[model samples]
Target: MQKAHTSFALALSLFLAVSCTNNKDAEQIAPSLSAEASQSSKDGILTSELSKPIGMSIDQKNQIWVSQSGTGKNDGSVVVVTPNGRVQTAFTGFGSQVLPNNELGGLGHVLYQDGMLYVLDGLNGRLYIIDVSSYKAKDAPVPASSLNFIAIKPFVLSQNLSNPLDSNLYDLTFGPDGRLYIADAGANAIISVNLATKALSVFARIPNATPTIQAVPTGIIYDGSKFLVSTLTGFPFVTGLAKVLQISTSGVVSDYRSGFTALTNLAPAKGDDLLVTEYARFVFSPPVVGWQPSTGRVANAAGTTVLGGLNEITDIERINPNFYYVLSTAEGTIQKLKY
Candidate 1:
């Protein structure tokens, strides 16, 4: 069963490689933005000292917290970046492993709510909780040894399912009921956790994109009423197949939108508008090594491109009506945009 789990992980790793190229080439892919949308756009804040940053969240203090999946050596960490770009490590020494395809997996996503920081360990199904209410931007790093974690894999394995050998606790969001809903990429399902009891349950099983392609759930968000999930469709990634799913608070899953390729994350925009990350379009043919450079994009619910030419964009955070931050894993930088 463990071997089966590793195989599933290796397949997902093929699509999670972070590019090391600069964003200068990415700007050329899509040179045009809407006149109103292009009012002011500039890469903001932290650019250096990032290692395969995957997940990001903003707190009440307006502090930006980012998770780095490290160089696949158990060096994964979560850092707090102040509004002025001062970076400080908050937690260190999480599990980081290099997959068979050379992709790194470790800290998956970070969520800050109230006074606690919820972190997901992708390589090993676990959730680490830290009290960051009193943590300042200049405070020293918090070692993982002092934090408490909840083992999620054992609970996932206990549930009888068709494909239950593996569990990759990826992106997560707080549901209306105050439970933590996690997108398990390996199991292809949403797992809900009761914070009060630390109990786990399979909330909903995501259907495959096609007859053979699994809808690997990547990022999730709660929009007051329902939960929205983004998927990175399985191997041999077909263009225009990836989509966002709508899951009810009661656990019913249905399609919300389609015609996307390699969707990664979603964020609420002005009014009912939604911003989604199109991670990247992969290149499988000869002479093309991996994903097409700068093909990644930030699009709306209607499939309209808002920002294009991004490289491996994994997360998007909206700060206010006109301000936003985008995390480009490949570029290892946070891009601030005003619309």
Candidate 2:
């Protein structure tokens, strides 16, 4: 996902000419026994078969769903990985493209709720809905052409905004009011969708991280009372400039926390804290014009690092109180962190 910074910028420039874009449980064990169990259960690498995975979500049955922005050949897909590391392709053949920077662009973040999977396509600007209630681990892969989706670009372009021509529906979360709130990285705003009516509205426009750079809002989550959104600041991708914005249920946005770099996703932590993914720092030198490897990390809302040395980290999912699954697009692997 760090590669997206340059790729998306290139795409946005072209548009000026011609338009486009948890879990838990158990209480009987002693403190010592539980601590040992937690330590032993942290399987660092869940699976290494993913090809440029950009998003992830855990289901009711503890299955991890990942969206892969395939090798830019219209082969994008979503796969299901069991807790034991078993992987199965659930859907395939979505639109994908190889950006000018050689980065894969297409599939974005995914969400699973009540047996339904919400897949976001950043390249095409569409939200796909797939019914996976009966999709067992043994079920065969399904073709994306067979499913249904809602084209968000049309609705987003219809709204009056500073940048209405572009719409990249990057990440989404269901609010307390049951509306799907999406972080539009391209449009630099939060969009709300009425699931029942399929209506779209601009909830809030993200302010610029700096006077010259746009705030590319990426990951988002609703914490019962409000929405928390993360930003991957534009251009030079300056360090310690990205922030996590807090939005009221009614769409008022404000700075919740600052002093982070290239934030990609957010998750609820114990109490009022949050677990965020720092994708990576940008290297603008000619020899290394991309994300600096091993600079990504998992940090708390206070900007304290929980885990570091991550390469191109894209998303983070909290499975239980003691563990988190962190996705590294560069490594094409998920590392289970014991918190």
Candidate 3:
């Protein structure tokens, strides 16, 4: 184990963006663990292979909060990491173990605004709100009551949806008008939840996707006027079909740009453009875990490479005008990069 603020350039594997398995017969991308294959940092960058880090956000105090979707039910947790790299537990032990098989909720993306922390429970199909105003930083679990979780339906594992994949909640963001938008890969729809009234409804769906394939939405970001979403079409995510769409506030959805393979996460970049990351590369074979060898790269709005040769870059967080923090899922560490 390494301490905070240590710099070591690593080229880690960036795994899949959305972490839900819908079809039992579907191929699972569960790659074998290897620090040798993973912890290959270089060029003097700070790295720490935190466990299952997915969603991230910088709070008002500049503290980094990462929601880690642990490998099992009842294992999901969140950690508050400083920009300098020191890590501490924000909360833990919140999900319940379901009956029959002990299936538990998996924590995915997290958003922080004002004094509230919003966490998307990807596995359990619920959302959680945590107020960190009085909580002190420590690497220990807090009271489960303090977690403030809302149980959505069982959206994963044993979800009994009309469409099996409809239960996959991949990403979430808060709009300027004070509403939370969610990206559901299983249903390929964007759902919104009103925090004040606890009202949930379908915001939009794939209005122009190929009916033969599943155009699942993975990542979503509110960019002033509209919400930009990244969609993954079909089981083995194809390049041409992995395009970003712009959804209006009234729920009108349309394509914005293309030329990505298994696009997973999206973020607002400098001046009217966006930063998108690919979960995997254009592999000709069926999707396997960690098959793309540093095939992932970060691109600008015009499909130009900003950071090339990445290993499954899952999420990108802009710290300032010219600096960003990229989450390399396969490497299990967050690396700093300048654009």
Give all candidate RMSDs, comma-separated. 6.6, 5.8, 10.5
Q: lDDT order of candidates, best first?
A: 2, 1, 3
User: 2 or 3, which is superior by TM-score?
Assistant: 2
To one decimal, what is the Cα RMSD in angstroms of model 3 from the true structure?
A: 10.5
What is the C-alpha lDDT profile of model 3 across 114-231, one tens digit per residue? 6677777665677888787665666466644466665554423233332433365667887666778878765567777788887677788764345555666777887778888886
Clashes of 3: 12
Error of 2 at 70 (Å): 0.8
Would you estimate the TM-scores of all the predictions? 0.87, 0.87, 0.79
Q: Which digits, one per residue and each the tens of the lDDT, describe model 2 over residues 11-110?
A: 2232222211011111111122234333434457778878778888877677789998776689989999876666789899987887665545688889
RMSD, model 1, all Cα superposed? 6.6
The order by descending TM-score is 1, 2, 3
Tell me the spans in candidate 3 whose CA falls farther than 4 Å from its real position.
Answer: 1-44, 94-105, 143-146, 154-162, 282-290
Clashing pairs in model 2? none
Cα lDDT, all candidates: 0.75, 0.76, 0.62
lDDT score at residue 272, model 3, on the 0-100 scale: 82
Q: Which residue runs of candidate 1 sit more than 4 Å off their true CA positions?
A: 1-48, 162-164
Better of 1 and 3 by TM-score: 1
